[model samples]
Target: MSKSEYNTEDFVLDPEFRKWVLTNDPEAKRYWEEFLSTNKSKIQEVEKARKILIHLSQERFALPDSEIDLQWNMINDKIDHMEGLKRQTKVVSLDSWSAIQHHKEQSRQKRKRNFIRTAVFAFSALGCFIFAVWFQSQKFDDTQEVELSYETMEVPAGVKSNYLLPDGTEVTLNSQSKITFEKNFSGDIREIELVGEGFFDVAEDSLRPFIVKTQQVSTQALGTAFNIKAYPEEPISVSLIRGSVLVTNSEVSDFKEKLVPGEEMFATLDNSTWIKGQFDLKQALAWMNKTLIFDKTPFITTVHSLEKWFGVTFTFENDIPKNLFVTGEFKDESLKNILDGMSYSSRFSYTIDGKKVNLKFKP
Candidate 1:
């Protein structure tokens, strides 16, 4: 039969359909998606078949093919034995058999009908037995403990990394950032633990919420783009680029705030108080696009930004200048150029040793 006419049984028994439901094959995914889109009327049947296939894939090892065949054979043997008894019951003495041959023939026909009915019942029983076994196997699987594994990705200082999650969410990790998540998110929720800084373009799935947890706060999104910066010993900042997200204290659930586009929420690690304010898109995403913008930033804060940007460490020999501010916009500029430009105004000298930089007050 053509695919358009295929019934639930046909789909369940199809090898290709089973493969698509069980494995990660791009072609199979496309084919099924397209098919379902065009044949919306068949969605119920398709879903039923898909669920059965997925269940079978999980419990396939519970019952071997050989064992299933042995059970069928045992059922059939019992049916055959009953049929033999029916045949023996139809026998009669020779004198009575001739005298009531017509009645005897009717009785024989009745016996045949009884045998057929018994065979059908036996087959139906067999089906019920198989279904029961599958149901019990599923129950056993549900109760069994599952050990979850995790995967981690880290971006060192002076570098950035981009990753695509299994659910098609896009993430860009900033310098000295790390994210850890389950290797296979086969659960109801999609969750990630993040440290440092990262930007996310989350895919929308109302059924499963995407969550990013930091040391101080947690950001939850349902199909939104946002940036989060939560470095140790610094205030946690969450910026929303598009869509909306809920920011909540990791320890205190009641301390929550909602963020909209072009808005930022900040929370300190020590205090759970949340502060929301307007944020500059250019300043927030400069690092992602390989640009640096220091808009009236303090001299010491600038030093920290440079270290993270260039993957270097900074040390001060003398106390940093009080009330010193620096402002600049650099697109793909070298660390030396940035420091040189800043020094022309800040009037401080700096020396570089491998990955370390030292600043001292000039006499």
Candidate 2:
């Protein structure tokens, strides 16, 4: 039969469909996405099949091809038997019995009908028992745990993005950030590795704590909203907006600190000690609102932020002023406008050509 006519069972049995559901194959993903797009009605069937495959795959005891075929054959045989019984019973109508001999025959037929009903009920009960046994067996077998496939998402410099995780957590990724996460949150913990900065509105899962792992630290939260800035070579910062988070230094696994609302944790990659204190939420989350807020920030740091914010490469034509600091807020401002504002105060001339900007400090 054509793929469009496939039912849930058919989809589950399909090798290509199972591969797409189990492994992270770009070709399989592209094929299935295009298939579902055209065949919209089969979406629920495909999803149901995908879930069944995922469950079976996690248990590491998926039905073998031969076993699957055998079970399906048995099911089809049972269905055919039920149809035959229905046909036989349909021919014997109540109106057909009239004479004395016929009444005797009807009495015998009634006994046969009762026997058929009992047989059908027994078969159904047996099927239910078998299903229950299989389900329970799969549920409690914890000897083997399989590793799940992971996928990575990267946002290039000068562009910010947002993504929804499998567990319904909302993530607002800042410019030049990358996040690597599991394709599905089937593990004990909903974990993700982040590079650069991201704001997480974590989904509440009491059973599975949402964890954001940076190079030097790991932040664990359950139903909390927080932000983490962990760009390479820069100090890592975890700013909690609401709820609470437990921050642990990866280098010093014994070191852990709990953070409450409005608190921020700062840890340098080069240092083992971390500091926690109150933070400015607006300043921390300014990128989310397409704004940049500088609080007497060093010129080099400000340039780094601007480079990521506008997707530009900055080159110093002359020696950068060591005393230069910028303090301002620019919301949805052009790169030229921001540069102009900064140049007026910092006494620097800059030329923007394509993606590169050259800065010359006025003497």
Clashing pairs in 2: 158-311
List runs of model 2 lying over 4 Å from the truth. Answer: 1-53, 57-140
Q: Kindly list the per-residue Cα lDDT of model 1 for residues 4-109, writing each as its tens digit.
A: 7877767766667866666635677677768877888887667656555555555453446677577667656776787678778865556865759957776986
Among all windows of 10 consecutive residues in model 1, the one with the lowest summed lDDT is 133-142
What lDDT score belongs to each candidate, Candidate 1 first?
0.80, 0.81
User: Per-residue alpha-carbon lDDT of model 2 for 322-358, expressed as tens digits?
Assistant: 7778999999999999999988999989899999999
Runs in model 1 deviating more than 4 A are 1-137, 140-145
Q: Which ten contiguous residues of candidate 2 have the minimum total lDDT?
A: 133-142
